[model samples]
Every structure is written in structure tokens, then in C-alpha cells.
Target: MRVLLVGAGGREHALAWKIAQSPLCEHLWIVPGNPGTATLGTNVDLAADDAAGIVGLATREQIDLVVVGPEAPLVEGLGEVCEAVDLAMFGPSSEAAQLEGSKAFAKMIMLEAGVPTAAAHTFDDPAAAIAFVEADQQAWVVKADGLAAGKGVIVPDDGNVAATISAIHELAATNAGTRLVLEEKLTGPEVSLLALCDGERAIPLIAAQDHKRIGDNDTGGNTGGMGSYAPAPILPYAEAQALVDVIFTPVLRTMAARQIPYRGVLYAGLMLTPNGVKVIEFNARFGDPETQALLPLLKSDLLELLHKVATSNLADVTIEWHDGAAVCVVLSAAGYPAKPRTGDVITGLDRLPSDVLSFQAGTATNAQGQLVTAGGRVLGITAVAPTLREARDKAYAATELVEFAGKYQRSDIAARGLAE
Candidate 1:
């Protein structure tokens, strides 16, 4: 099949690499794709946000399948557009995407479906939101109702809800975010659980833990994701299954009953509290740094799994995961989650380990035709091994092969596993 993947991020790069390994994927292409995809297939000169441009390319290219990588396009109804043209697409329709597109909407759905989740309130006006936050004594979570590239949610430990309101205003000033969802922050370790919702069934993927903070100890502003590892040692297998059966299944069934068939990956970022697993947030697409880690541990043919979901027979298919552990460490440009300098010369990428794969997130070729860092969270060095320790070590070893001016990474990618 000829597949067209959208977006230019680390997640997309990992997907491209996986697709290349599948016998089902005869041809592949990417639109507004990154420098990494250029080596695999044709990279069309169109932005991921340009819905019309994507449709035009699909029509011209006669794309057999369209896999959306980022949430922005999915929230904008990329899948719906493809459906109109009879194009087999992977990702949720805009209506189904509301689970991730609007935080308030997701909370309401979970409430209606009796799914385990945090209590949340929605407010359109800034003043009202601030007032609620000021009076709330518990730790709080503030979120923009719409998408902000995984950086819209704020978990405040001191209950400073006003900062969330202020941040929304600041983002709105720059044409970013509005209507807010204020949630009572649940206490516990966070886990990113992703599964394929094939309109009627939930096909589980590997469980992962994403390190959102830019610094080593998880301190510092969130920037998509810095690093991640699969089969989180902390959240054991039995505990993860309970969350899926008690939480994810109920939510997917509710969507089916509502007549909005969810047909893509549903990433439920959960807080495993003493009480139970509570939803932190919902993501319409695959997690970036998490994807980098999970893909390497996927033993099954990805194309076959995706095809089953798109065709909607996921009830019978079993998605298999490798017994080994996988880890991914992100290399970032200086000053991430804020203003970042780009176009720095990168080196040593050619020496990447045979067992490890380096995925380019935001990268470009310089005038001299060398791949250069073009985004804050640039390259994802992913590797797999029998144990989490081996995976972490392999990822770090691969990280050493890559370099550029102002390049920095966490010395500890899977440090959380050490707590055990």
C-alpha cells in the first residue's frame, strides 16, 4: 500500500522507520515531513496544518492510506476529509477527536460513561476561571480547551490556578488558546497508556512513561517530551490491565453508543493514584517520545495492525509486543519550551548503533546538505534490549554518536526505573 504520513516530528520519523520494515507497506510518503523522512521516501513541500494542501496531494498521489502523526491535523478533521474522498485514513474524526481536542469535553464524556477520571470544570471567561482556582485548596490542573502541541496543560502543585488563566491569555494573544478546563490534580505517578480504538474495540499497545520536563530530574518546563521507556517498570502489567478494563473499555464503548466511532490511537495519560488510575489527559494521536520507545518494542507488523483498525475488525486482532524493553532519549537544542535557536550543524549521526535508531524530529539540510537541528526537541535516539537497564544503556550509547553545537540531553533517560 502507498501510505502518506503527516507531520514532521520524532513520532513521525519513528512511524516512517516502522512502515519501511513492514511488508504490507509497498510505498511510503510524507507531507510537510522532516529531514529524516527524506531518506525513506518523497517529502512533499506542504505543511501538516494545510488541510486543503494535503487533500490535493492525496488526490494527485492517489494515496492508499493516510496516517496522521500529530494531534493538530487530527483535531482539525484530517481523517474526515480523507473519508470524504474514500481514502482509507488512520486517525480519529474531528468529532471523535474531541476526546483530545477539548479537555472539558473529555471530562464530561468520562463522567457520562462512568469512566475513572479526575473531576473537572470548564470556563470560557478568564475571570471566572481565576476565581475558581483561587478558592480551590487542592492541587490543580489547568488546560486550554483546544490543542497546543501537548504543552497546553499545566499541573500546579500550589493551586495557582491564575497562572493557567494568565498563560491562556498570553497564548491567546499570540493566536493560541482560549476556553479553559480546570481539574483537581490527582496525586500519583503519571503513565501514558495508548490503545487503538477501532470504532467498537480497544486494541492495546505497549504501555510507556513519558518524561515531560526538560531537565534531568523532571524539573523545568514541559516541551512535548524529553525521553521515555516502554513497559514502565513502575506500573506493573496487572495494574495497567486494570486501567484498560475499568477505564479505557468503558470510554470506547461510550463513543460507539454515541454514534461517533473512534478509529485511531487513544492515548490516555493517567495518574496512578492510591485510589485508582485517573485520566490526566487524552491525546488523539501517538505520543512522540513514547512512540520512539514503543515502536522498537512492537514485534507485530505495524501495517497489518493499522489496516485491521482502519477496516474496523480490531475485535479479533491481537497486537503483540516484544518481551524486551525499549527506551528513547531526546536530544534538544538549547532553551527549549521557550525560544530556541535552530540551524546548528549536527554530526556523528552516521555512527548510530545498529541496534539503535536515531529519529529526526525537527531537522533540515543546510546549504552544505548536512542534516541540522531545526527544533527544540530535535532527534530521538531509540533502542531495545532484554531489560530496561539494557535498553537505557543502549539508547545512551547511541546518543553519544550524535552531536551538534548546543546539543544537550538528560544523563538519565530511564531514571524512574531505578526507583525500584
Candidate 2:
């Protein structure tokens, strides 16, 4: 089968790598992929959001399946465009994608579907939002209703009501046509549960934990994702399946009842609170660094799994995973998550151990034909082993080999999983 995977990030590179390994994959193509993906398949020069270009390419190339790696294109209705052309695309439609596009919409769905989540209130007026924060005098998680590239939510310091109000004003002034969803702060270790949906039933994958903060020990602000580890000991596969019955099943039933069947990956950002497991947010597609970590442990054919989801035949497929752990450490450029410096030559590609996998994200070819940093998060170094400790050690060791000017990474990744 010919496959055309969308997006140009580390997640896309991971998907491309997995797809290329499938015996059924007769041909593979990536739209505007980075250097890492280029080594796996034919890298098309068209942008991922160019709906018309993607449709034309799929038609011309006779691509059997189109897998989207990011949420932006799906939120922009790329899946709808593919459907109009009678193309099989592995992403939810725009209406179904509202689960990620609009936080307010997701909150409403959770409330209506009897899904467990934090107490929240949506406010369109900045003054009203500020008044609410001031009256509560409690720390709140302020989130922009619309998409903000995984940096939309701001978790204020405990008892910092002033910071909460300030965040409200900042978001109100900057996010146009967007409201604010202020949620009561929930405490616990977070887990990511992503499942393949067939518009009727859902199959849960191994759970993962993502470190969102740029600095170590969970300091600093959130970027896309700094690092991640798979099969987070906190939520094993059996527990993850039980979560599916409670979290994913209700949401899927709600979506189907509303005549908007959800297809593709349904990612649940969960907080294992003392009270119980509560959802933090939902992502329509796969998580970034989490994908880099999880894909290496998957023993099943990725192309077949994705094709089944796209065609509503997921019920016939049973997923399988390796009996080990995986970890991903992200390498960032100078001053990442605020203002990242780019165009620095990278080295140590050839020095990575054969067991380690390097997935590129923000990279480009310079005039001298040298690979250089072109975005904040540069690359994801991943490794798998019999234990989380070994995987973490291998991944961090690989990070030392790769060098770029002002390169930054957290000293501690997968530490929580190791402790668990």
C-alpha cells in the first residue's frame, strides 16, 4: 500500500519510520518532511496544510492511505477535504476535531457525557474572568479556548491569584475570538492514553507520560513537549483498558449519539488524582515525544492498524506491543519556548549507537548543505530496552553525542517512571 503521511515534525518522522517498516508499504511519501524522514521515504516539498496539494498528490500518486501526524491540519479540515475527494485519511473530521480545537467545546462534551474532569467555568469577558479568579483566591489553570500549539494552558503557582488574573488578561488580549476555560487545579501525576477509534469502538494503547516543562524538575513554562517515556508504570495496560471503559467509551458514545463519529487517534490527557482518574484534555492526533517513545515498542504493523482505523475496520485488528520500555529525550535550541535561535550546524549524527533512534523536528538544510536548527525543539533521541533505566540511560547517552550551539535538554527525563 502507498502511504502519504502529513506534517513535518518528530512525530511525523516517527510515523514515517514505522510505516516504512511495514511489508505492505509499497511506497511512502511525507509532505515537507524534515531530514530524518527524508531518509525513510520520498519527502514531498508541499506543505502539510495545503489541502488542495495533498488531495492532488494522493490522487496522482494513488496513495492508499493518508495519515496525519499533527492536529493543526485536521483542525483546519484537511480530513474533510480528503473525504470530499473520496480519499481514505486517518484523522477525524473538523467537527469531531473540536475535541481539541476548542477547549470550551471539550469541557461541554465532558459535562454532557458524564465524563470525569476538573471543575471549570468558561468566560468570554475578561472582566468576568478576573472577578471569578479574584473571588476564588485559588490557583487555576487558565486555558485559551482555541488552539495554541500545546502552550495554551497556563498553570499558575499555588496561591498566586494575582498571576491567575494576569494570565487571564494576557490571554484575553492576545487570543482573538477565544474565551478562557479556568479549571480548578487538580493534583496528581499525569498520564497520556491514546487510542485508535473506529467511530464505534476504541482500542487503547500503552500509556505514556510527557514532561511539558522546558526546565528540569517540572520548572519553567510548557512547550510542545520536552521528553516522554512509554508504558508509564503508573498506568499499565490492564489499568489502561479499564480507563478505556470509563473515559474513552463514554466520549465515543457521546460523539456517535451526536451523529459525529470520531475516527483516528483519540488522546486523553489524564490526571491520576487522589480522587480518581480525571481527564485534563483531549488531543485528536498522536502526542509528539510520546509517539517517538511508543512507536519503537510497537510490534504490530502500523500501516495495517492505521488503515483499519481510517476504514472503520478497527474491530478486526488486535494490537501488540514489545515487552520492554522506551524513552525519548528532546534536544532544544537556545532560548526555547520563548524565542529560539536557529541555523546552527549540528554534529554527531553518525556517532549515535545503532540501538538509538534520532527523529528530527525543527531542521533545515543550509546553503552549505549542512543540517542546522530551524525551530525550538530540534530533535528527539529515543531508545528501548528491557527496563526503563536502561532506556533512559541509552537515550541520554545518545543526547551527549549530538551537538549544536546552545543546545539544551532536561537533566532528568523518565525519572518519575523509573521511581514508579
Candidate 3:
């Protein structure tokens, strides 16, 4: 079957790798794909959100299936257009994508479904938000209602409360009318649990931990993702299953009960606290750096799984993962998440260890074809091995070999997971 995959990040690259492994797949095409995806199939010069163009390509190429890798296109109603054209799309419609597009909508769904989550209030006025924060619920999390490339959520330190509040106000001012969701910060270790949903059933994937902080020891501002590792050591077998029970099932059921009947990946970001696992947020597709880690561990044919899910035959499908550890270390251009520097020549990639796999996030070849620094989170160095220690070793070793002007990465990725 011919497939059209969307997005241009490490997540899309990982998805392409998995999909390409399927024996049933005859051809693959990635729209606005990155350098990594160029390995799988023909890369098309099409924007993920250009719905009409995508539909036109699907029609022109007679692509059998459309798999969307990012949330933006889904939020923009790509699935709706695909359905209109009778195209089998592996993404939710815009209405269904409200699960991730609008935090307020997701909270309402959880409230109606009795799903566990942190206490939060949706705000439109800047003064009102400041007053609420000053009133003090101890500690709080301020989030931009719309997608801010994962940097929307702010976790303020004791001395930086005023600055954090100012940042929140700045975001609100930039996107006025777009409300902000403020939550009384839930204390715990945050984890990412993703599932493949087919409206009626959802099959869980390996659990992962994403280190969002730019600095070591989980301090500093957030970027898209600093690093990630899968099958979180902190959550034991029983604990992991319990998390699914509390966070995934109810939420999926709620989406279905509302008649949305969600399809494609359902990502639940959870805060595993003393009480239990409380949902931090949800994504309608695979988490970026988490995908970098989880995809390598998947033993099942990704194409088969996605096809069955879109066709609503998930009862016959099972997601299998290798018994091991997979880790992804993100390499970013200097000054990421604020002012990123680009156009620097990259080096040392040829010297990377053979065992390590690199996932492209932000990159574009210069006129001379030298690998150049391009985006905030530039590339992902991923490695899988018999143990987390081994994987970490290989990843760091490969990272050492890869160098570019102003390249920066977190040295202590998966430290918490390893410590436990």
C-alpha cells in the first residue's frame, strides 16, 4: 500500500522508520519530511497544514492511507477533508483533536468522565490571572491555551515567581482572546503514556519519561524536549498498568461517549504523584522525543497497526515492544526556546558509533550541502540496548562524536530513571 505520512520532526522520522519496516507497505511518501525520512520514501514539498494541497496530493498519487504525525494539521481539520474525499486517514477530525488543541475542552471532558487531573482554572483576563496566582494555592502552573511548541507550561521557582508571571502575561498579551489554563501545580514525576486508539479500543504503548528542562537536574526553561527514555524504571509492572487504568481508559471512553470516537494516537502526559497518577495533559499524536525512544523498542509492524486502527479492527491488533531500554538525547542549536542561532556547519556525524541512530528534528542542508544547524531542537541521538545503562552509554558516546557550531544538549538525560 502507498502511504502519505505528515510532519517534519524526529517523531515523523521515527514513524517513517517503523512504517518502512512493514512488509505490506509497497511505497511511502512523507510530506514536508525531514532528512531522516528521506531514507524511507519520496519526500514531498507539502506543508502539513495545507489541507487542500494534501488532499490534492492524495488524489494525484492515489495514496491508500494518510497518517498525520503532528497535531497542527489535525487541529486544522485534515482528517475531515480526507474523510470527505473518502481517504482513509489515521488522524482524528478537528473536533476530535480538541483533546489537545484546547486545554479547557480537555479539562471539561475529564471532569465529565471523572478522570483524575490537577486543579485548574481557565482565564482570559491578565489581571484576573495575576490576582489568582497571588492569592496562592502554594505553587501553580501557567499554560498558554494554544500550542506554544511545548514551552507554554511554566513551572516557576521560589525566587522567579514574578518573572514567570510576567512571562505568562506576555504570552497572554500575544494571544489575547485565546484563554490560558492555570493549574495548581501537581507534584510528582511526570511520565508520557501513549496508546493507539480505534474509537472503541485503545492499546497501550511503552511508557516514557521526557526531561523537559534544558538544564541538568531538571532546572531551567523548557524546550520542545531535552531527552527521553522508555519503559520508565520508576513505574513497575503493576504501577504502569494502574496508570493506564486511571488515565487512559476513562479519557478514551469519554471521547467516545461524546460521540467523537477518536482515532489515531492518544498521548496522555501523567504526573505520578503520591496519591496516584494524575494526568498532566494529552496529545492527539505521538510525543516528539518520546517517539524517538519508543519507536526503536516497538517490535510490531507499525504499518499493520495503524491500518487496522483506522479500519477499526484493533481487536486483532497488539502492540509489541522489545524487552530492553531505548533512550533519545536531543541536540539543539544554542539559545533554543528563546532566540535560536542557525546556519552553522555540523561535523562529527560521520564518526558517530554504528550502534547509535540519529533522528532529525530541525535541519536543512546549505547550498554547499553541509549539514547545518537549522532549528531549536536540531537532532535526536537515539540508542537502544539490553539495558538503560548500555543505551545511555551508546547515546552519549555517539553524541560526543557529533559536533556542530553552538551545539548544546543535556548531559544528564534519564538520570532520574537510572537513579531509581
The list of candidate 3 runs beyond 4 A from truth reads 136-138, 158-164
Better of 2 and 3 by TM-score: 2
Q: Which candidate ranks first by lDDT, i.e. highest?
A: 2
- Over 1-420, each residue of candidate 2 has an lDDT whose tens digit, in order, gives 999999999999999999999999999999989988999999999998999999999999999999998888998999999999899999999999999999998998998889999999999888999898888888898999888888888898888999998888878876532699999899999999999999988999999999999989999988999999998999989999888778888999999999999999999999999999999999999999899999999999999999999999977677999999999999999989899999999999899999999999999999999999999999999999999999999999999999999999998999999888
Q: What is the lDDT, from 0 to 100, of the residue 355 in candidate 2?
A: 91
Worst 10-residue lDDT window, candidate 2: 169-178
| TM-score sort, best first | 2, 3, 1
Better of 1 and 3 by lDDT: 3
**What lDDT tens digits, residue by residue, belong to model 3 across residues 197-230?**
8887777887899989889988788888999998
Which candidate would rank higher by TM-score, 1 or 2? 2
lDDT of each: 0.83, 0.93, 0.85
Worst 10 residues of 1 by lDDT: 168-177
* Clash number for each model: 0, 0, 0
- State every prediction's TM-score relative to the real structure: 0.95, 0.98, 0.96
**Model 1 per-residue lDDT tens digits across residues 1-420:** 888899898999999989888988878889888889887888999999888889888888888888899888888888888898898888999999999888788988899888878888888876777677567644456777887777776666565555655654654443335787777767888888888878877866767998988888888777788899988977776676666777778888888889888998999898879997787788889998999998988889987777777878787677777798988999999777697679899999879867788989978999998888898898999889999998888889888888888888888778887565
How far out, in Å, is residue 277 in model 3? 0.9
- In candidate 1, which residue ranges exceed 4 Å CA deviation? 137-139, 159-176
Question: Whose TM-score is higher: candidate 1's or candidate 3's?
Answer: 3
